[model samples]
Target chain A: MEGCTIIEFILLVIAYFIGLILLGIYAHKRTKKTAQDYFLANRTFGPVILFFTLAATNFSAFTFLGFAGKAYDSGFGQYGIMAFGTAIMAVMFYVIGRKVWKLGKEKGYITPPELIGDRFNSTSLRLLFMGVMVVFTIPYLATQAIGAGMLIESVTGASIGWQIGAIFTMFVIMIYVIFGGMRGSGWTDVIQGVLMISALTLAVVFIAINLGGFEAANTMAYNASPELFTRPGGGDFFMPMMWFSFMLLWIFADPMFPQIFSRFYTAKDEKSLKQSMILYPIVVSFLFLCPVLIGIWAHGVGLDVSGQKDMVLPMMVANYAPGFVYAFVMVGALAALMSTADSQLLSLSTMLSHDLPFKKRKISEINIGRMLIVILSLFAILFVITSYNPREGIMGTLVKTTFSGLAVLCPTTIAALYWKRATKYGCIASILIGETSVFIFQYNILPTFGLLSAIWAIIIAIIVLIVVSYLTKAK
Target chain B: GLWWRQSEPLMFGLPFWVVYLLILTLITSVAFYLFSKYYW
Candidate 1:
């Protein structure tokens, strides 16, 4: 909280940005002029880069800020829901990702829509997939900007507003992604992923020691809010049905994320993808515990994060850790969001350029993709600055909008991959009907039967896909 | 749900369910490793 410490934090952040720009320049030099090279890094990612990029891309503001905030509001059940659910998702990385990788490498597919469209031989389905991904991903991208804005506002003690922080975060991400493309983002992800894990581990250690170590901290938290230690935690948020719903949701939704989906194509071989899958659960199991523990400990230590639970991690760090630790942790937090936003912008841009039926021109697709990154980033920044409300909290916003909407695509995707009988009509109906149901359920227009809207949406989409596929198969 | 709802018998300062979940994650990781080595 010292002015000097704030100065140190600003300096460190500037230096970090410089390092990223340098990496971007290096990647730009390595990048070939082809669309595949820019968008998919020429399918040359080794195991290590693939693992880190996948990890860093997936663990966004959602993991760093949103997880802690949800833990603060709900309880430790957050850990069980996230860790176990995501671990289970690693199975899909093989079941789904392996196939996607094989197909992409075989067919030279660049984007998720291209793969799906080629399989079904339907341009309409491809456009629908692209449309859904773009619509859903933008909100998730906004969450990263929102997290950056909140972190800056909290770390600077309001000398800097959230709008400035959000814009600055988007601007830096755009520069690197435009320069380096996937290779740039992938390499930066390696550094950012390391920083993110190291900072969280260090922050947790410092906070635990400050609270008289892990046992004492846990005891204090339990005494302060015993409900957090149980399922259907603090606010009765994680009921049995809801818990089941969440676990199921991650399996379907996570693989469908355009950023994550496109990553399947970037791996050098099946071995790299397999290694990433195996490492994912082990890494997630440890990394997630840090923020959840910090959130619970903040409550135990009585940090008064009521209504603004998303700030719990930052508030705790600023109050408990030394200025150096605080500064490093904030940088790590920035790394988390930036790593994700860059990937999201790049993936979305790739889809827009490659999948959409734009008129042919002299401009190469890679250049068009670069221009789209800036445009998409501007839209995300606008969303954060004008539309985002910190009070709604990141977790709730993501679950309601992005997570549920994307999750609905799972059935269609699965059928597309696994079921030979799946027709274009079935895929189209599944997506349209499923997404509509998600919208309806999210708005409470229909009942969710004590489950998340995503669960119902997935179910409906699967049935529609099967029935429609059968009915249309004779044609 | 009933078992996890109980808060007694903390392990390493974590609630019983939290430890249980961590153990489950480890088991899942082991499963993934096995799959990666032998099956994948």
Candidate 2:
């Protein structure tokens, strides 16, 4: 992977910034005055916009970079596990999104903590959920920062220092987010999201042409290793992982994950919510295939990316494609990176300002949101200098240990929503039991079963919440 | 595994560029129309 010209890199960055600045300014003017408007786009986002936002927002750096990397490294073995896990993630959205939207409307909830607090009718229970939320969120945020630095380095030939790159990336994002809220964030995501799709799609076409055709990728990936081609959950322990991935959706119970559920509360009504889910997965399935193609193509050609599997897209394009195609492809990779970074920075800052506060003291929620944008943007900056090396794939960073930790949250949330008898005591007991059990296994012991301890914790937690709430006559 | 990368010009009348953009458009159009009728 060589010869990314200085002129090409600068022009691309310039074009990107100009487009972003124009949108950010327009969105700033369009920005509404209320807290609800700032955080949730005043609940006015339509179908296409919300679908792109969810796809753009949820499909983080990990998908763009790490998925390719893992495919390069482990090939089909990783694909089956990750692909199935991700598809299940979408299904979870359908089942949980409707319920969360319904409850959110009735309760007027703002963050995940709000759901927990309202459901248990207790401050402490909400606090427990909040703690888990913050801890898990940091790593996810760090993954974005790590991605930002890599994008700059790849295009610029590392001419810019890590500190300088971090500043520029964060500064552009913070200004728009601070001024415009979801209006700015949403609009920018549209731009970046489009760029992302264009870029990845371009790379796929280029590689597909070079490698022969669409079938070549899968054929090569399989002939290289036949065992890897099967569906992910079709194996011995596949059900457990599928169940683990499926159950992880209880995060819908958390109100602060503004990327998706915020759409629910602000949605014009239940119809938009239902419709988005029905069609959203089709887009996901289509977009999902592109990078996998690039990975398999790279594999066939012997484009060895070593440890940093995440760099497969950039490396393949740079090493193999025509210069024009290379420039265009970089846009998609950067698009994925920026789409995720911009929205997340906005969400993270909002949660800190709005959710962290004990009470809404007369502070203009919009200004406070902007202020937190600047503060949290610094975290990405810190991650750049320290995150010079690729840590792991996107699945590693985004999913991580939290997938299991979420199991505990799931049982209580289900019991709360579907079962009226679920008590506050039951919620607390479930979270404590489930999360502790996950920690024990993640750190102390490897599970005899591949599914791990989180599932077990969730099972026990559900039993406890049900039995206790029934016995105590829960409120 | 043996097929040539250059053989296929477009996967379904749209090249990768056209295909992904089409996917994006189809989703947005359907969702936007529905959203307008229902929420907007």
Off by over 4 Å in 1: A2-4
Q: Measured by TM-score, how close is model 2 to the native structure? A: 0.82
State the DockQ, from 0 to 1, for candidate 2: 0.05
Question: Candidate 1 chain A, which ten residues in sequence have the lowest lDDT sum?
Answer: A1-10
**Native contact share for candidate 1:** 0.76
lDDT of 2 by residue, A87-133 (tens): 33444444556677677767666555667677767878877866766
A1-475 per-residue lDDT for model 1 (tens digits): 7434666777888899999999999999999999989999999999999999999998998687888988987888899989989988889989889999999989899999998888898999999999999999998898898889888878888888888988898998999999999999999999999999999999999899899999999999999999988888888898999998988889999999999999999999988988888888899888999999999998788898767888889889888888888898999999999999999999999999999898856898998998999999999988976877766878888888898889878888888788888899998999999999998998899988899999999999999999999999722
Model 1: TM-score for chain B: 0.72
Model 1, DockQ value? 0.74
**C-alpha lDDT values of all predictions:** 0.89, 0.63
